[model samples]
Target: MAGTPIANSSTKCLPEGMPSIMGAIYPIEIMQDAKRLVVLAEFLSQTRRVHIGEKMPPADDTEPSYNGYSVARWDGDTLVIETSRVRPDVLFFNVPHSINMKITERLRRSSPTLLENKVMIEDPDYLSRPYSFTFQYKKTDYKIGEFVCENNQTKVDAEGKASLQLQPDTK
Candidate 1:
């Protein structure tokens, strides 16, 4: 397990050194059947970005690789997600989360169509603390559209490359 803190940012850019998988995307699909809710998202990569729905806006060129494979199941009203088999190429930009890194997310519906998600990131290779984050989503009635990144283009420079920006320990 790679030890690394999954950086939190309003932007979608992943940290440096973390390779984007082939099909990772946000606003994953949640299918509910009886007591079970299944969530699905593609694992995306720099070389191949998966088209799940409508093409999302291009992330910052300076951003690290984005996207990963994730699935979630509902436990009662709370959603529990387990993410694995992550690509080690860019792990959170440069922090280097291992491919064995495992992430768990807990989600709860704050409203009929709104869900709040709390994510926990764990890795043995790059993190000193377990990273956590929260995100919110609203349900939409629109159908999924074609999302493709083949035409999206950006220029990368040395400064744009993902890297671990560590702060000095205050202790």
Candidate 2:
């Protein structure tokens, strides 16, 4: 019980961290300092801050949140991040991760202007073995927009049909 607010069976309302984990599939903004790193995604305005060279806190100190408890270390030029304690949430392509799940990400500089993140996901409760993939990001000067998820941003109309605003220009 990591105090993660999951959607109840009766109410399919979006949870507190609805798209935080879901946003993992898209582009991210990486902000790093001497002791920590921040992974930010414009969509849903989700962010995960990883403490560098730090051990996982005591169990009581961690909650099964969207991004889970993440720690990172440098392996030569690459940064290795290990994350656990994620709630049973949709982590990738409609796949849910159990609390026992762990994700290992190896991020390295592919080129002077390109970065790559190779992720490995493991969850015995759902996945057969480990799933691995890589996502790349090109260094850019474009600024991130202010994107936030609003309550009932998506809704079912009177005819009992779900309506989703998919256009990027609309809020």
Candidate 3:
């Protein structure tokens, strides 16, 4: 459960939005197998995409509408995920990434009580080089509860219009 911090403590910027769902916690029962892991990640990724007002256009249309495409794999006890083809809809620390951006993540279960996640972001459109980050989570015996972001709504005024507040200076 060791790596770089996901966010800069000094800055209060929210990259995607105020209600941005970066990670989740699930019962050990749900993550018992690779198939389950893939299913859970896909489900969560889809949920996040839809939350950001991104849409899946008709297959016939050449233009892209979806924010990002993700694929997951397992490396020993670690789950490696690669995401690309982002639609420049959500901002990273209020800075947007282009459609060519790609992100890689590695999730490892360090112990029965802890899970470690490391994320690498590569976007030539916005960043000078690939930046990596890590996030740690503690396990709990509590059952998984219903988690929803849309239910709790909050608005912020940015550039004279109401918008979701994004975490600032996320690296």
lDDT of 2: 0.68
Output the TM-score of candidate 1. 0.52
> Which candidate achieves the best lDDT against the true structure?
2
Best candidate, TM-score: 2
lDDT of 3 by residue, 113-163 (tens): 887878888888778999887767776665544433431233433432333
lDDT of 1: 0.48
Task: Give all TM-scores, in the order shown.
Answer: 0.52, 0.75, 0.56
Q: Which residue pairs come into collision in candidate 3?
A: 13-167, 13-168, 14-166, 14-167, 14-168, 15-93, 15-167
Could you tell me the TM-score of candidate 3? 0.56
- Distance from true location, Cα of 89 in model 1, Å: 1.5
Reference-based lDDT, residue 153, model 1: 30
lDDT of each: 0.48, 0.68, 0.49
Output the better candidate (1/2) by TM-score.
2
Candidate with more favorable, higher lDDT: 1 or 2 = 2
**If ranked by TM-score, best first, what sequence of candidates would result?**
2, 3, 1
Least accurate stretch of 10 residues (summed lDDT) in model 1?
A: 15-24
